[model samples]
Target: MEISNMDPPTRAGAVETTPLLEGDGKRSVQAVDVVPMKFRDMPVAAESIRKAFEDDPLMEYFDAADTAPFPVSRRKLIDMVDWMGAMHQERMLTVEGGMSLMKYGPPGNQTNLPSVAFLRDSLGRLRPEECAKRWKEFGAKARELVSAAFGEKVADMMEIQVLATDPDAQGRGYASALVKYVLRQGDADGRDVWLLTTSAYGFYEHFGFVTVRSGKVGEDNPAWDGEPITLRIMHRTARASLAQASSEPKSPVMYTV
Candidate 1:
């Protein structure tokens, strides 16, 4: 993906941006707000993710499946995000007018599932029987890969499941801010953060995440053609200390407020 022009930084406590200021006629300046959102924000979050992941490898792979018409890939992704948000509440963050990030802790941390009504609505008019076979095939392969990568202690780690920005808001700094917040949360809690990405491997590396393992995703599956797509699993180790000394203040990574 191509990188777009970024918005300029602003004062920390301001929620609204200053009047539009043009720069070189190529870009403009505006303040963006990044905050943790509540459950009521899922629909907007889901839409943002669906739009961002429209061209994503994983979503495209699913869309190419034989049962694609019966079960829409984007809809499934939106529902998955909703279910994950329900499982991991406060960990989900939304950037005002820009992007959203959803993460999940260990299985033990998930106290409940999304409601049946919500799930039904997410699936829309599609029948479960039509998609069951493909779902099982995808789930089994993904689970096996994850299990092989993390082993028995997977329950103790954090997973960055979703990080998406509205296409219209891509030029802004929303992605960077959301990433900083989640990484700090993981660091403060002293838990390793793991994620799987087919693209954006370099983007994550800028913030200290490193690849742990990589493998083919669509190999031997009818959903794909020719060579299989590569999927990378990355991990970031937890920091022993979350703070810096006043005398040795680090360069600002992102706006906190």
Candidate 2:
């Protein structure tokens, strides 16, 4: 069977920020605010992605070339999230912000923590090179679609973060819509979405991504430089999935509230 597009639905024009109240009924750290990452948030997103990289000794290479010990680049940060959202329908939002402490501030040493700060690795992983390669492959189309959709300097690359909905919103398919949205963006841009993960391979595979052996990836990638870790890669064509999504009856919506 040929695969098709599974673009998610986007309800709002931009990220919305809400306030998270504490048990004492005071404002929490995240302030219950939600916003799709903007140009201004690039720095904060970069810092956030870096801290996430720091938590994983295994993922350190994601920060830079094997020779470089620090971050690969700030662009890598935006690219990571952009691609992540694109690949995951910007689904990383629920866990995006809270990752800082786990990534940077302290080693499991947080003060006045909010519930949003889940685990550090919540957004998942990516090597800078992989991000760039996919972006280059998908850039031209992405520039056209994303530019038209958002009206800005949408790079051949992108970054994304999406929040799952609440129980009150259960069965509404928010998560599914977000997933579809990213896939649609990829389709419009003519790029295949790529991502790495320790688990949840099944979820993505259903979308038509085949699991690639980590060995195959390591050997294929020079960045592994002959020392790739135990990792798995999954990817699907952005355009095809969107085509499929549009042609078929939508799947049953699954909510996370």
TM-score of each: 0.67, 0.31
Question: Which runs in model 1 stand beyond 4 Å of their true positions?
Answer: 1-32, 66-88, 110-135, 241-257
Against the true structure, candidate 2 has what lDDT?
0.34
* Model 2 poorest 10 in a row by lDDT: 101-110
lDDT of 2 by residue, 1-257 (tens): 00111121111111111223357943333322333433444454445444433433234333334332233563344334443333232233322333221110011121112222122123222324564442232323223333333243222323232222332332333333444555666677675554333233444444454443332123345554544433333445455555574454323222110
Clashing pairs in 1: none
**Alpha-carbon runs more than 4 Å astray in model 2:** 1-37, 61-178, 186-192, 195-203, 216-228, 237-257
lDDT of 1 by residue, 1-257 (tens): 00011000000001111112246532243455666666566666656666777676655655555354534454745455454544455555677732454444433442224453355445543534423443444445545555666776566676666577767666575665665666776777777777666666756665566666666656766645745656666777777543331123223221110
Global CA lDDT computed for model 1: 0.52
RMSD of 1: 11.0
